[model samples]
Every structure is written in structure tokens, then in C-alpha cells.
Target: MDTGRKQNLKEARTLQIWNVIYDIIEVVVSLIAGFTANSSALIGWGLDSTIEVISAGTLGWRLHGEIKGLDERRVERRKMITLYVIAISFALICVFISYDSISKLISKETASWSTVGIVILIISLAVNPILIYYKRKYGHKLDSPALLADAKDTFICLYQTVVVLIGLLLVKWLGWWWADPVAALLIVPYAAKEGWEAFSKAQRIKNNIDRK
Candidate 1:
């Protein structure tokens, strides 16, 4: 491989590794705050972070294979497996979030405001935009669509956090108990969409490879 290609792979690997670490911390903190505050949005957010971790890891694996000069077919086969797994995971997230949000609604469970949740939201809002900027920069530099797609996913996570923050504030200030579940419910359609996209992309890749 050329020097430029090597550097790009290294940078891409570093970015994905960073995402894995960040999402690990995110999953722990979000889940803790979610259960403590009885916030369905937070729980759904954490679940989404878990999917982010898997997605990032898959990208990292693909990049590593490239760096090792693996056959393109081999690398693509692995990616296909990863994409299928991601598709299933997203589907599971949709079902999980839908069930929880609906149950909360039926039970009339009010989300309690959490100082910790608010604090985490503030931190994520401050940090994620910077991460998104770098991810997009390196993604373009490397000309890697997978990296670009991952960047998009990061942006979505950032958006989800913003919605959750707004919903929590509404619940606390306006006594809107349904706001939490409603915000969480919003995530379902997006998750389902992502699942379908991933599956379709995987199918396309598989068909192309099979024709070869």
C-alpha cells in the first residue's frame, strides 16, 4: 500500500476506536440515568449507542482487513455479515423501544427529571458536534462511504439527544408525562428505516458479489 493509503487507514481506525470508547461510556451513563429517572428516552438513547458501538466496530474491522491487504471479496463478505447483524439489531431496537414506550404510556408513568441526565445531555451536546466534524473530515479524506455513513449515524445520535433533552425539560416544567415516551417513540420509525436501509444495502452488495 502507498503511504497515503496507510495513513488514511490508520486515521479511520483511530476514529472508529474513539467511537467505540465514547459509546461504551455513553451506554453506561445513559442506561444508569435512564433507569434512575424512569426516562424511556434515555433508555432508547443508550440502546442506540449500543448499536453505534457495533457499527463502528464493524467499520474498524473492515479497515483493518484493508490495511492487512486482505482480498476484496473476503473483506466484503465480512462486511455483509456485519451489515446483516446491524440490520437485525436495529429491528430489535425498534421493537424494544416501541414496547417500552407504549407500556409507559398505558401505565401513565411520568418521567422524573434527572440532574445527571441533564448534565450528560449538556456534555454530549458540547462534544458530539466536534466528533461529527472530524468524522466527516476524515471520511472525505479517505473517500470511505462507510465512514461517511457512520458519521451520519453519529449526527443522528446527536439529534436524538437533543430531542430527549427537550422532552425531559417539557416533562419537568409543563408536567407532561407523555412527553418522554412520545420522544422515545419518535426513535422507532428512524430505527426501522435504518434497518431497512442496511438490509437493502447488504442485499445489493451480495448480488453484485455473486455476479462476479
Candidate 2:
């Protein structure tokens, strides 16, 4: 490999590693505050964070393969397996979140406004768009589909952050507690879409392998 490509891979690996660490912290904080506040938005954000970890991990593994000169077929197979697991997991998360949000709406339960969630969303807003910018830049430069896909995932996270922020602000500022579950329900279709995309990608990979 040329020095430029090698450097690019190194940078991509570093970025993925940092993504993993950041997601872990977000997962813990979001989940804790979510349950404590009974906020479906925060809980859905936490679940999405978990899926981000998997996406980053898959990209990291692909970068590792690139660096180690691993067999292309073998790496693709591993990638398919990872994506399948993620698709299944995300589908389950979507179902759970949908059920919780619908139940909360039906019962007319009000989630207590969480200052912590507000603070976290603010931080996420500041951080994630910047992450998306770099991920897209490097992903295109490196010709990495996995990194590009992860950039889209980061974009989704940013969108979720904004939605949750609006929901929390409405609850705290305007006494619109129902906004919480409604905002969380917005996450469901996006989650299902992503899950379907992943599943389709996995199937395509399997078909390609079979053809080979």
C-alpha cells in the first residue's frame, strides 16, 4: 500500500475507535436518564447508540482487514454476518420502542422532564454533525462503503438528538408531556427503514458470494 492509503486507513481506524468509545458513554448516560425520567425519546436514543457501536465495530473490522491484507471474500462474509446481527437487533429494538411509546401514549403517562437529557442532547448536537462531516470526508476519500454508511447513521443520531431536544423543551417549557412519546415514535420508522436496509444489504452480499 502507498503511504497515503496507509495513512488513510490508520486515520479511519482511529476514528472508528473514538466512535466506539463515545457511543459507549452515550449509551450508559442515555439509558440511565431515559429510564429514570421515563422518556421514550431518550430510551430510543440509547438503543440507537448501541446500534452505532455495532456499525463502528464493523467498519473497524473492515479497516483491519484492509491493513492486514485479509482475503477479500472472507472479509465480506464476516461483514455480512455482522450486518445481519445488527439488522436483527435493530428490528427488536424498534419493536420494543414502538410498544413502549404506544403504551405510554395510550395510558397518558407523562414523562418527567429531564435536565440531564436536555444537557446530553445539547452536547450531542454540538458533536454529531461534526462527526458526520469527518466521517463522510474520510469515507469518500478512502472509498469505504462501511464508513459512508456509518456517516448516515451518525446523521440519524443527529436527527434523533434534535427531535428529543424539541420534545424535552416542549415538556419543560410548554407542559406538553405527550410530546415525548410522539417524538420517540418518530424514531420508529427511521429505525425500521435502517433495519430493512441492513437486511437487504446482507442478502445482497450473500447473493454475491453465492455467485462467486
TM-score of each: 0.96, 0.97
Q: Residues 1-212, candidate 1: write the lDDT tens digits.
A: 89998998988899889879988888889899999999999999889888889998998999999999999899888788888989999999999999999999999999888888888888889878877888898889888788788788888888899999999999999999999999999888888888898899899889978998
Each model's total of backbone clashes: 0, 0
lDDT of model 1, residue 114 = 86
Model 2 is weakest, by summed lDDT over 10 consecutive residues, at 113-122
Q: Global lDDT of each model?
A: 0.89, 0.88
| Clashes in predicted model 2 | 0
Per-residue error (Å), model 1, residue 130: 1.8
Candidate 1 clash pair list: none
